[model samples]
Target: MKQQTKHSDARRPLMAADQSGQGARQDEDASKRSWGSEQLAAFEDRLRHLRLTPSQQSLASVVLDNPQQVAMSTIHALAGELGVNESTISRFTAALDLSGYAELRSVCRALANRYSGMLWRFMRADHGAEADSESGANRSQGDGKDLAGKNGTSGQRERRDILAAQDSSSIAASFARIDGVLWDEVVTRLGHAEHIAVIGLRQSQAVAAMFAYLLGLVRSQVSELSAGGARYLDALRDLGPHDCLFAIATQPCSKDTVNVAQWAKSHGVPVIALTDEVLGPLAELADQVLIAGTESDSVLSSMTAPVSMVQALANDVAAVDAAGTRAHLERQEALLKSFGAYADKDL
Candidate 1:
């Protein structure tokens, strides 16, 4: 019975669109205009069909309540408040076929400012028509329970239809930026830094550690800030003027991460932030803000773009010191072999 219910729920979006031509047309127009209404509707539909993870559902509710105010800039803070990672916010944006949270915010703001009058009237008329149609359908059904069931089904269908209308190209384009000049810039920065300090909290902390490890292979003076309440403050105390802070922060922002960036800036340390949007607080504090794509199909945040950025930086740094790095590796390999660290199985 549960399986049957789930199947029925999945089909509800299509059924609702079939029943409401105007609603379908409105969604289509919103997609064409790159207005966020279509994306918002699709997310709501997916929630109804697949049942969002609790965190996703919470994020969805927040977006719905403040459609105009919510932006990619706020993703990290929102996620933190919900006890989820910044990546989750990226995934949510990706699911909507938005390049990332920044694009999503631009669309929402554009739609709100450009079409507010028209949208208000359209929404009022649509709601009135829907209410009338629902009333008539209920009257025709006669049985109250049957009417209730039909209304529930209709609501479910509306949500699915919206999800089906999202654009794939938008999502692909958002991710494509990672392979371009932005990544090159990140690589150049890492290659030049005298000392690198990687700072991130929660999910971003893992990415920070990866950057530190990769930098250590070539430059030696690389350190990763520990997770919150894990000796990060003590580690950061050693940061100085010739150092660079490579920060990874995403929406639903972290206070500690922002503070670290600010501190680095005040201490005459350069800050490079890998982030989702330019409007985020961390971006304002950063010497360089590398915008990484965060669109994903699941509730989890998308790390592919940021990871690619880090790998590109690693490669570039290695390239810049190729001869020296190779010589160092050879010496280390020889020492390890002499110590039997690379001994064969027969030995």
Candidate 2:
């Protein structure tokens, strides 16, 4: 919410990694946005809404898909890679209404940062005062509401509403990409696999653990890679053609997940990737790719949509082999009840 540093006033058409200067850093933060909007939307959403010429479309594809690479590349390198003149690349930025290629690089760098687990995890918000002032101004325009009169509860409720709306939107957009047939296939493979190994490291591990637990309830031989006492590779010792490896990764995809997934693929293990981008490293290694939107308003991207999708997948897996799943559930319930795991079994 800090005031966007004014680098250029004129904007037109289409637009490199200069990571050194303080001015460059400020521009990067301010320029973090989809071409069509003031703030960033999901990359896919932005692509879908934009009206791009064939040449521009091709260029945008390269830029958007490889933000990390582009963030580090100079305009000359990018233009050469795409068989376009450097001037043409600058024109492409103009088409997107950017001031120039420099602003474009800033945008891509900011975007790439969100996908970086390290950067996203550690970056702190430094715009609290600016953000509140803007919010109050917007409210004034909407209903002439005085900020001083608004209670703390109103602010809290507004924040909650924003979070809920973002989550709901994210879920809807992600689910739209996967069709019924694909989902059915996912359920069948997971349900009938001889073994299931789910691997997620870092923050992604939280979702992976929950997914593994849900899968365990519906079937046997469901093991979580890297979640328990055993190291992930050690757990993979017995994994092979008969088993499946489900790996969850996000932007600036984790190398560990990608490497493990690659190993699984080489050993004939089917890899299902739950990731934000189809072209992401983990998705490249996956035999089955499940795309999920992870865009968020804050430094941390939301996992709510991906977590919801996995939950639904678990439910479908449970229903795939109804009789077998029911028997498993009954046995598990009896075992837990026998151990008095429930405080009130009847309830």
Candidate 3:
């Protein structure tokens, strides 16, 4: 996942945020950059729900299934290629809410550009140009002649952009693998629990802390169990079938987290886990499992996707009982104001 662009120098992932358990966006969760094709998804949903004539269906597949070919073909050529009448092709585009074949072709062209390995090409072209420019400048400078640098920092920026794209894709892929049934089951279990204990260490500590904090705001009896002074063992002892254990662990899984999870599972305390692998140690012990990708360029792994999961869980639990949550938050706000723990924004 940490594919380096520069052969001469491997990426150090030397950023301070890597060690701080932060990212560039969403409160230092994931990379800050957005993918260009973020909103551009396949039209398979439209095809599934729409009814079409035989000729229209043929046209639909030709235009939407593989838009790259359609983008390069004229309307008449496309009609001929699909053995569909020109009128049928026009009708297909109309049904898709396009003005005509031109707009349809435009849409297809955009999709084709995105799916056609253009990102890799863009990086290669820019990187190669920068390398060539740098080489020429180096040779000239070695001969005691100075040459201006070209594309100064653009190549470096593109490298970071590619990594951001990779992180975005990983986040998307991780979310896509979620099981709807298990998600609802876990949400219900956590929302209705009597107590919730969160355990995380090393790379997973930030995620566990955030989940515990957010879950605590909407529901009491939520705690982050650390191993300091054997206190977590005391906390685990109180867990029972009525309570839930939320565990977070990734590569190089913490022994304490795993032991605590095993303890919970054996004691009949429902365990829910957020982890990086499908078959990790935490996953084995968890009653319910959620997966996220921690692959990153740095020596430190990423927790971006896990942070997103924490937000989703806390938010869903908050929504389980609207009235109770609202009252709880109101009381919490009053307590905070009374203690003057936070500065009053109105002042």
Candidate 4:
């Protein structure tokens, strides 16, 4: 007869097995760190127990959001938009353990390329199905009046019609959702803000400028931070508790724009972000997030949705401040009339 082993003794082998499994996991993790040496080093050196200093994090998120087009020119513009000094931008880079803005950009570009390829593949797959269906329909239509021909033709036509209707309905539904998500929030937030600071970079700067101009008509203290050079930072420094920032960032985001948002948040300022998707880091920092749809026929970002949202917000703000806005508008109209800025047709 063999001696009986205690339950605890029997469990010893199982416990040892578990420990071995944990050891393997640790080894695998070590291997991964070794494989991604630069990334791991950067992460450990810069991001370990990393604090974003608010402004720096905001700016970095913006740049990370729009990986494809981030550049020094964009960064400089973003710094102006956020009302932060250029040194803040450099600090943001160092915080990421990047050599500077350029290296950060190179990393973003690589990421962008990877995403672009994936997007193209998805697009191709979508179109491929449509092509196959269309070809099948044509073949059915080409056949004469045999039983198969009649049945196939009718079936194909009905299917095609159904698909067309489905496409139309899908597009309409998407647009409606976009309108609700983006424009409605913008209007609501603008109404709540005592003062609005508009921030945008690169192509979005125009949008920011336009929003500020229109908000001025409502007698709102609307500042366009995009054009003030270092003065932008001075202006931001002066904002009181009642002020809110409306940051416009699309994919890919400008690093400067993100930094500014971080800065504003750290200072206890509220931010309303208009961007492409909720996944963007800027959206994470925003008190209110507005996601605008970017799917369009063009390769460039579709600004139409965001522009419409801004316009709607401006209109709502004006309506809310009706009396003051009307007076301000009248003054502006009088000035324009005196300058003969209207069309000659009116004259």
Winning model by lDDT:
2
Q: What is the lDDT of candidate 4?
A: 0.58
Prediction 1 TM-score vs. true: 0.51
Model 1, span 96-123: residue lDDT tens: 6665555545555553444333343344
TM-score to native of every candidate shown: 0.51, 0.64, 0.55, 0.52
* Local accuracy of candidate 2 as per-residue lDDT tens digits, 246-316: 99987767778888899899999988889875546786667777877776544467899889989999998
Query: Which of the numbered candidates is closest to the native, going by highest TM-score?
Result: 2
TM-score-superior candidate, 1 or 4: 4
What does candidate 4 score on TM? 0.52
TM-score ranking from best candidate downward: 2, 3, 4, 1
For model 4, the run of ten residues with the poorest summed lDDT? 138-147
Question: What's the residue-level lDDT of 239 in candidate 3?
Answer: 93
For residue 273, give model 3's deviation from the true position in Å.
1.1
Question: C-alpha displacement of 94 in model 3, angstroms?
Answer: 56
